[model samples]
Target chain A: MTRPPPRILLVEDTPTQAEVAKALLRDMGLEIRHAETAGRALADALANPPDAILLDLELPDFGGFELMQKLRAEGVEAAIIVVTANASVNTAVEAMRQGAMDFIVKPYAKARLTVTLNNALEKRALTQELKTVKAQLSRDRFFGFIGASAAMQAVYRTIEGVAASRASVFITGESGTGKELAAEAVHKASPRAAKPFVALNCGAIPRDLLESEVFGHVKGAFTGATDNRVGAAKQADGGTLFLDEIGEMPLEMQVKLLRFVQTGSFQPVGASRPEKVDVRFVCATNRDPLAEVEAGRFREDLYYRLYVVPVELPPLRERGTDSVLIARALLATLSREEGKHFRGFSPEAERAIMAYAWPGNVRQLQNVVRNVVVLHDAEVVEPAMLPPMLLRAAIRPTAPHLTPMAAPVVAPVVAAAPVVAAPAMAEPAVAEPVPVQALPVPLPEPIFVPVPPSPPALALPPLPPPLPSVPVIEPLAVMEKRLILAALAETSQDVARAAALLEINPSTVYRKLQAWKTAGEIP
Target chain B: MHALRLQPLGLCHRLGVWVEPKVDRLASRWHHCHVTVLDPSIAGQLAEDLPRADFLLIINTFRDDLARLTQELTAAAATGDHHSFHRAAHSLAGAAAAVGALRLEASARLGMADEASTAPPPPGLSARIATEAQAALAALAALAQGPG
Candidate 1:
């Protein structure tokens, strides 16, 4: 269960808008995949459905509505977040009707993205948890987790042990260790399970807005603060607050956070009165907090405050043949997704999965399985079909001690009946992972039906570019001209009324018009 | 989240788009903007464009616009389009002054004079203007680099 961040598909045409979004969400703990056109976006989504999609309506190949419709039909379940310059209600209503999670306009602040993405990530986490819980086999698993190895067994024990307590739980693991999943497990096992579970990755948001994100901001708090919205801290009141990558938080904000943690009160940015919230804190980070403290990057007092009950997650390489187990699980799920029957992996492929150091953990395994399901039609996945890294890996024997625990789960899954594909269905319960060598039953036939090629493009008017530069005033002069002309025409050439509407002197307007005429700029 | 930003040398802390505020006395009388590097209004507008806009980007944009307008002014003078020359030169003058380049501003204003009062500008004017703009840009680069 190497915890991969939530995967997000970003469909945007303009580089600046994409760049802006990346900067804002870089610290939010989501893995973002950018697609400049609808074709690429569809390809990516079809290959591996993301947890969320930040879609730009105006695309080169198709409209967002068409893409969303296609994705829904194909069982791609990622939440669609509509991002456009025009935040019109009609667009909002249409996008929502087409299944958008939320709508946002351009020139958005760092705080704005934080709120939107946090909600999307939460929905995804909850959905995954729900699916995992509903599946009969998953009943034995903790949340949406599956691992019977000593490492995962220890994690389950820790989450169960701490479930009833109100103590701050700090979970630490390398990049793919399922830290967020573990956090969700903690929330579900706790008394606050019925309440909300709000989480934020301290590393993924802009520093200026991080305070506003955690503590919330008032209207006009900063340049782009157009409305007042509650932050995660307040939103998670009477619930649990999980702060991932707590190590990445700025030191100054750490001081403020320490204060809030000590006394359950905080003031939103630009707010006069402080707020009090009753919430439990569950924080996590990959780096050694003690090292961070020595480096002077992390606050020592804050570390001690948050590191009460630390849960260390194991990396994939150390998890023995769990890669094979996870890969089979992924194959079962993704094969059904692609409607391809990849009954199982070849002996060499199994050996490679067992031997390769899966630096990307379960997420990478999922992708590799996806790669095979997408490109090849064979029932058995050969090592050559695996990623080059897996093929080039030194084939090490599976650790003997870890082999026995996975033996019992392999037979049940293969012997069991094939599961049908349903869009809103819960995840099939994760069986005890069956080691590759322990697999006893013969798998079903390889179905060679490849996915039909995409249909003709659904053309929609492309959105205008975000950065529109004018040769003269660039974008500004045009706006100024429009304002002036609108005022002039509205007043029927009454300079006084037009100037009053514009809050400018009539003489100034007259002078500008005369200058424009002199320069032959206006008729 | 506030702790995660990669700030540059204790300067304009932003989304890795680090830009330090002015270090020299450019906003004073000795320098046209000895109190600030660029006109406060324009600087504010730039910041508005990117509330957390990096100072490095502003410097880069200013440098690019200065070089481009210098070329435009030269081309207008070459074609004997005095009005175009005046427009380009005036535009350059305003932009240069806004960014605190006194020498470049003065040079650009030379092209702003009416054609009726003076002969068309000579070819070397462009070269001189270019040189001044280059020097001004170099100064800004130094300001960005700081003592280090």
Candidate 2:
């Protein structure tokens, strides 16, 4: 559990000064490595990073300032203290500007060297501690995802746990639930963070071009392919390739994708040899992938390969209070973007936001907040500032509680009507029970016959059993029409936005509207 | 003498001596005179502050650098290479100040200022620098050998 002594890299061309620095640093219980030139110092520091560096300005190869710049550019996090014979104020200033923690003149006292080095080491430790704290704080707002709800916390935990592994992560969520953000979070948390993170939406690309889009293409591969191109898979070498809407990927492409996923190699369009890349795969889809597999839309083998690790993002309604949290955050950001001065939402607005089911999830919330910001300028967002659809949904009542009288009486009446035998029915009785099935039948005329009091010995068979009633069912086309109309209404007749909320193409919605208009179904 | 010989620059670049026959004869003759080698206050402070082992190592390194830099300065002066002479002088001054050799540092600084002149260096400037360097090396040797 004990930490190793801090190591220092002493970069001084002057051997005498270097030895002096080594002795002083060693006396403080630190490990020392000496480099007589800037080139050697750079190579050593990069090969084995030290805890701190004591740099002399007048290196034989290059100036100390240039060396500092190169070290920082290469992501050397060690603290640097510039030790130079020149005691000019400008030199000290320049060194500090180049990220040197401290500047010391040559022939320094042992006490001064000790204090400066200790201070630099202590500062470096504090900086590292701060970075760790920041990373922990990022859980509440991970790479573009903002929520502290239990459902979101679980999602964060899943991403963090699976990021280090090379297994393909399959993220499932309702549309607008930040699937791409989760994929990016995984990439950022992984060891490949410094590499590329390439994302391709499988559903957005045309089926004919999806293969070439994913695996790159050579010149003249297709009719209009004028030049060679690098695709997402190649671009994400040593990093992550995120395939969004994977369920929408054509079945034919899935087979090719399966081969690529299994072998880490793929032949570009019109290419003889296959190119290989080291890439981690993270795929996402809003559809029920299992259902897609059952229906034969998605390849079962590909599904198993890519679905090694699953992360399901809860819908906005399931993430309690997160809607309001996200709304407030969006309001602040949207206000800033629109150059508005809105402080926050009114309590009534917050309640409305919480009550309404965000069917479109965060994306819808963002749109609503942006809509309010662009149209209205106010100190606080009142309930009236909310979208009309959201307001209507928020005020809608729940299903009514049923009383005994209001309950269905058809079953009991139908059962009891048969118990009253035909003989009893023949008596002159005005209060005889009538079968419920007779309600829907058309009668020639209204006729009521009186029954005799004396019962006949020969009892007529019980009236033929009433015809069975069939449950009414709406046609699928009608249902689809109703849903499309409702979505359009909710989005205020914005076809594109409605299509997005419904997870359909805007072109499809436009075509449907045109057909309806031509048939006089819609005006 | 043993400490000076242990410098990392090798035996050819020994203090108060040179490999080139011309500088070697001139350096041997200049070593006879007595002069202020180093400032007592500065050198003494350095000696009292450093560990005995570290101080000895520093003295040896300083000896090696002095001989090498003096040779370079003399060669630059002989060829009238003003740029090289100025560079050597600047480096020499920094080395001198580091070890508390104030007079040699001042002399080197004068050499640097003279670099702006259109004429060759003032006569005997290299000899003056050599004498001062030899004196400073002798004093540093004595200090290293003194009671720790």
Candidate 3:
């Protein structure tokens, strides 16, 4: 059966411009669905999600950004290409950073639009392919590492291959991509597996003490050298010495390192003569060694010596759905540590994790899972339980296939302010809805809305006074004042309720109240 | 209400703007452009690198951009948004040059370099820009519709 041409939702306010764009895109054989207002667009997207959406930032009802946010929070996985006449570097950056696959400025060549659209579609196709691949992948856990992506498999193979060889192994990758674990894996697989595998972060140590930290210190090396300390090199003698962040090692230290790598000998700080140790060297750095050498920050000869057998670790973002595999593994570990029972991430949570760029890589992923497991508890880890940063990473329009009973149907309430529509429920909407829940505000008391019983299934929670769901950028003082005012309103001016809502001590609210009275900002 | 809302915002910028009559002069004199709407060299390279459909898509984009930018120039001028005008001009210059609309690009280059000493734009500058954009649009439309 032939698949229908990929559907594209073009959300633009201007009819003429939309017509022009629609005419232009029609030639590409793409079926274009045009929605001029944000509310309509939101409804259209939810009703029948397109394969890709070309969004205009400035919509008639509300900003298209708000609609995009809602779609993402609802876990829409369609590829989005944001189009804006208000083309500026800032707008382009924010759009892409918030999950737009691509951004095209106005007056763009039809060629540019097509290229962006095609690329987004291609990316979506690849992501879908990865999902299938992820399902088929086996051996999700390897050694101390957890990942089932082809990238991780290659890394495992590299570790196994390099382990038997005595040649110096150099690992490179961005921070949190598990370079240390790779080194340890290499050591564990090596002939010297029984021996201790000592590791040291070269960048973490102070410049003046790096030499002592790596090569050991004699009894009277410096003023603070209280006792003779065996350093990383001596400690890892007859085993593997993993020097992490090796690029940050001072130039003078590079000379010693080059000498050490050349000959398995090094003098301890303030020691009389050279000492030889059969230590296997495994160096890792989170920098471009060649670029460092070119910039004169790193010694050219030292780079060549250590760049011998390089094993580059891929960043978490490039590892496809390996994030899901790793997240499951991490959740299991974290839940055990926190004494929480989490079977795994809810599908939406998993989808969100998979879509995130993971700029901090595995370390960031670990921290997020640990934090979620520690503070929140549920049968399954949901998106709301994750950090605000992850919550903000609701881009990459994927399908929210699960017919979730709890997802608040995004019904626009007011004609004048379509942007402020939110869930008419007490329990939060999934996609972490908005930062509204993050504010220290208590839920309104039941007395505020006297509800006569209807069908139990038909009843919805009473809605609060609407707040704009769009993320706001404001100064700290303004935000604090707003929070206090909202807290007061939500709690009906009850001081205790307000304080409890704010998660602050009652006395702190009392002090704030008095200060506001003195300033006459509050009546 | 004799409306303040109806009146244009800010006045100092409107005091010293200049309109180059050259654009009107340029538009009226238009016939078959001595040079092609697009640079023949860039087009040749793009044709070799891109599919025919992709090439047409580009031409269509250039034509649409010209229309959009012309619209933006007018809106910016009416609102006394010189900053918006500057950005539009800057983008117009880049897009015009990329498609090889030499005359339009040259005028847009001037707009990019404009200090905007006058708030939004002087009287007629917006119209002048629109003329250049329209001429470019016609050239591009011809280019798009021309035999591949």
Winning model by DockQ: 2
Ranked by DockQ, the better of candidates 2 and 3 is: 2
- List, residue by residue over A1-523, the lDDT tens digit for candidate 3: 4878988899876543465466557668888898978898888989988889989886646887788899898878899889875567899888987899989876455578788899999898899789865654555776788887888888887788789888888899988999999999989999999998999998999999999988898888889888988888888888999999988999999999899888989999989988898989999998988999999999998888777789999988778788888999889988888899988987768867876678788898999999888888887988767653343233212322212223322222111212222365565454432322122222221112122343322111112344433334455466566666776776577666566444456677788779988999999
Candidate order by decreasing DockQ: 2, 3, 1
| Cα misplacement distance, residue B92 of candidate 3 (Å) | 99
Counted clashes in each candidate structure: 26, 2, 13
User: In candidate 3, which residue ranges exceed 4 Å CA deviation?
Assistant: A1-137, A399-523, B1-148
Report the error of model 2 at residue A405, Å.
14
**What does candidate 3 score on TM?**
0.42
Using Cα atoms, each model's DockQ against the true complex is 0.01, 0.23, 0.02
The digit string of per-residue lDDT tens for model 1 on A1-523 reads 3898888999976554565566557667779999989889999999988999999887757888899999898899898899875457899999999998998775455667679978987887898888864553323356877665667777788888898899999999888788999899999999999999999999999988899999999999999999997999999998899999998898899999999899999999999999999999999998888899999999888888888899998877776666777888888888899999789988767877876667777777778889899998878888657764453242212322111121111111122424323223233322342332232222221111112253312111111111111111325456566667765775577677566445456788898799889999888
Lowest summed lDDT across 10 adjacent residues in model 2 chain A is found at A399-408
lDDT, candidate 3, equals: 0.70
On lDDT, the stronger of 2 and 3 is: 2
- Model 3, residue A471: distance off in Å is 20
In the range A78-176, model 2's lDDT, one tens digit per residue, is: 999998876789999999999999999876777788999999999998998999856664456777888878788889889988999999999999899
